[model samples]
Target: MELNGVVSAWLLSTVKVKKIKMSKQWGQKAEELEISNKVAGLGLGQKGSNQTSDTEDGPDAANPAEASLLMKIIRQGLVESKLDIEIQRKDPNSPLYSVKTFEALHLKPNLLKGVYAMGFNAPSKIQETALPTLLADPPQNMIAQSQSGTGKTAAFVLAMLSRVDATKNYPQVLCLSPTYELAIQTGEVAAKMAKFCSEIKLKFAVRGEEVPKGTKITDQILIGTPGKMLDWGVKFGMFDLSKIKVFVLDEADVMIDRQGHQEQCIRIHKCLPSTCQMMFFSATYHSAVMEFAEIIVPNPIIIRLLREEESLDNIKQYYVKCKSPEDKYRAICNIYGVITIGQAIIFCHTRKTASWLSEKMSKDGHSVAVLSGELTVDQRIAVLDRFRAGLEKVLITTNVLSRGIDVEQVTLVVNFDMPMDLNKKADCETYLHRIGRTGRFGKAGIAINLIDSPQAMEICLDIEAHFGKKIQLLDIEDAEEIEKIGA
Candidate 1:
């Protein structure tokens, strides 16, 4: 859901503060001070702000350096506390919201078992609100806007599974994704959820999958990309659309925004039975996409779970100041030296840039993987497998890896080239998605924006303003500070 302009304006006015100070010479002692302040900020006042050092004099009173550090710590604490409080205050509670157990949702016994086996204790906010509406007797169409990693997939997957008649396996459900990788991933999730339901057959119609000529698709569930789904449905006549009961458009915003995808999706939708339940899910909802969705999904129960400021609250965003393009490269290397990053993704603006950076970083003794549109499907899959298995430490790529791919161990993201649209203006939504690659499943993550020019810096500021949050500055020259910041 889009943020209300008035609410975002109010949040910016109140919570926007100067960037936090980073001490260049911060050692073990300074680290302790920062931790104490952070604890105090979180309401654990174990040590008072004015406590004295072991020298029988207050640290701030005896040493000017320590004093400056104390003041900065206090300022940082106040800023963080106020931001948290304001976000909590501005979040409006929905009347449809309720806390319920998976059993209470009345899911199929096998699906419920799968849910427990997957370790889901209860329904997420989206699932809580969407499941009942989606699984209602008179099947309803739904257009849901939720943040990444918010269990939107499970919600719809459950709906699809519940609607499918497993006894007769003849393609009762169809799901479409923007990319082949995403389609495969969604298919895997659905398969896992239907583990106990062995009768439910699934088929993927993405690239590289060959369906024999004149072969009827007997799979009860089909998940694939729009282009391939359309090809099989219209050209090959492989699937029976009249019997399909559920149709889902995962990552609906991306599909609608791309050139041919929207048309192909519409064609596939037209072929479906009029009684089919259509469900659309996306992290973003552009005005044009929403208008198109409205036309396609009749009387959809709209569920929006995103607020402007709280979208990126779990991510700690910072920008490294670089003097030149060469300096940006040096900064990248220096970052790896300072922090123990699990798995990081660096975003470049172009495929050329991604390839260049990957090669350079490899030369600099860093194992990096590159993914872009230029890579073939097999190459992309191989790279992703290596990265997911913890074999690769860094991935340098363009916008291809930006949306809908979840890597839990990815704790760091670097925007080597800030996202910009055709007009060269900061594409705020793209930036959000790029950073969102990390910080999955409510984990704390860091996103670093590498700014080497005035234009890049301006773009960073624009993103900051757009999110109503200040981007902290990182000095790459200071190893100690960089370690603390990365930590």
Candidate 2:
């Protein structure tokens, strides 16, 4: 009400007075005021003007910066509040976002053709914001802090792919990931996305796994894990990074978190061309990782999505708090009876628990399979393929399948073992990706977090706090409910 009253006062006053009135009206009634309150409700109430002065003063105001700090806080809170500001569609006559890319940067024909073949209609949010800085005259290095599933891959991929020259192919782009699975996954995407390049053949370097028994490193795009790629680059004497146009540290946070791999990443950076464009992409950013990235790409355009929480509209996330693990297991069985479940991925924290749960489920006569890092590539692939093909109803695994793997048929995700981090547990992105296997391509899906422990309760609390949505819990002790779930 105080807010509405202030807005009302502003609307009645002159533009200059409105600004002063707005500043003075904070923490006062605005919604419940005179008939002029209707003016406050209008869409055209000096958007962004209210905090303009605050932003200009920034952190250099009176009190040796304390006033500026206070102003900054006020502005941030106001912006995030989604109050007083009006949102309307852009005028149709107005131009859309600017076009900035390889063509804008004056790249050659081969690179341009590759970009067209990637099936990109235009730039995504990340691409639109970062391309100008990236494609600058001298090509400033980029430290992109964007969320996953928001097309960060395409931004860097296009930059790297656009740098490759079809004529001379000697591994132009080098991408480093944290794990072998992620490396292979990224390589696959690079291969497919770059398949239309025709001239650029991307290669994957897997340790102890020979590439067709006689594959060479003559590919234009080379993606691999740090250890394997570095080892191969050194062994094959093929790392001539001096001529490399792009160096990408994909998932920089994960890459550097390894015991000593951060130093290795620095070493790899040192090998790159002095003028090469370095790009870093990560879903979450830590201070240490950001500092490390500063060494590789100084003064990077920090592109933030600025979303308060992840979006899980396509994913139905719920929590089932049970008295014990057995009760939680029974709840899952009960829910299965009510819904026709497609391929479901059950997330467990440990291999032992995963295997034990699988065994117990098998005794209950569920067509279940288990997956963990212990599984060989072939074993994992077989399990994944079977699950994808709908041969298996549920497969249990750890975080290995968390980030990159996407199976369309997975309609349900059961968090049998709650995630350790609540911030991550209820994360809409991870939640979407987890339950995304089902309700894919506009299909409806469901995710159930089996909260059978104190730890699981904490995860539930975090989910509630993160999404600001309450989960409906079902009591499954009833015989009818138990029978339905078991059936």
Candidate 3:
């Protein structure tokens, strides 16, 4: 409510000053509420699950240097993406927070090295925030929403690792995935990250791998499909359900929506000790599933990144600031280790850049393939066939493969150049479709862009304005930060 000079004078004479001040405060509060509502109504979810400083995996807590580094990263505002994270903790006075790096989490020394060894120096937006809650001393259950391929596997894996006692290991951590492939994939990530921890062991409880009667299974972490876990933990009585410390239900949305998984999960949940840390991680959760989760896992820390549009929530997107084409190639080389976990699709603005990158990636000892509009239909088919068969981990191309391509294994997508239209404006549709190549079939995925020039920055800003999502900077020079590329 605006008052002109004459109206203000009249109000001062007619109304009490205290009443006028109260009215002004009410008007300001109303405007603030309207803005807050618009933001709250944004969509949700990000690439990876979150983490923070909770339980130390080993005796070595973070020193002053590490703590300083943590504060520095937070102060620097590093790794800023359009990931709007809202953390709801039961203790509002003692709120949980987001950490920028694993170093800040004060993890065990070996475990910290293992995180970096797994090519994860810093946590993704989700992992940084979600970890502390997962690792808190009294232990809190967490219901988290993150995109596929966002390092959620690693986040939960680290949580399980932090809570385990290798000396008394007998299946302390149990993770239930929805499928054999997902179980294997998660087991792979866990095994890789836990390698430096020495005493830690991970086993997949999928088909044809069951233990015979009277034999004990000693693996510290057990990952499996719901039915296998239910049978192994309940029917067979293989794992001492009471001894389990962490129970993770990955792809939980799918688990609940499936025909029989809900019952199996519930049966298994009933067997777990009250002290166990329960975690539910999924890309999307309907209100019904969320309600059910609330019933099963009480007092959970909820972290959500509001969604902007369709399928965008599935892709973890970032941009690298490069000075030249060579620098862009260097950025690719830096993240090559992380991107190779699954098949990758690197989109160039033109066929020349694609060909050049294909050559460089191959020369750098990567199994690379090329696809372009110049290729014959048969050639394109052959390239895709090789990529699908895992013969080529990296598929460099122009925009030809942007649409009608659904490779479940493609977890990484690289935009070596910004996308633009014929008028040289940002090509919002093509840009969306290009990154959409990854994060397909409800799987997690990562997308990176290289902005080398002022024009490229302009294109990125235009794309940013189009979607109302920020394209945060990625520094290839920082080895620690580089681990976050495909996370």
Q: Tell me the tens digit of each residue's lDDT in model 2 across 376-452.
A: 55666677667767788888776445533456677778877665432334444444445544555556667677877
Model 2 segments more than 4 A misplaced: 1-107, 115-133, 145-158, 161-245, 268-275, 283-288, 305-310, 313-318, 363-365, 404-411, 421-444, 478-487
lDDT string for model 3 (1-487, tens) is 0111111111011211224487876875575455334323422121111111222221111122222222222222223335577677677787667788788889999888888876675787788788888888889899998755456667888899898898885889889876665676667777777777778777777765646564557888888878878777766667799999999998776566555666677667777889899999876666666776776788888877675366777777788899888999888878874445678888776666777788888888989998765554456667777787889988987655554455789888888877765467787867887888888777788888898889988988888898877777877778777676545
Top candidate, metric TM-score: 1
Tens digit per residue, CA lDDT, model 1, 320-348: 98886688899988888888889999988
Clashing residue pairs in candidate 1 are none
Cα miss at 42, model 1 (Å)? 45
- State which candidate, 1 or 3, has the greater TM-score: 1
Cα error, residue 234 of model 2, in Å, equals 11
Using all chains and alpha carbons, the TM-scores for the candidates as numbered come to 0.61, 0.59, 0.51
Provide the overall lDDT of each model, using Cα atoms, as 2-decimal numbers: 0.70, 0.57, 0.70
List CA RMSD, all candidates: 21.6, 21.0, 22.5
lDDT of 3: 0.70
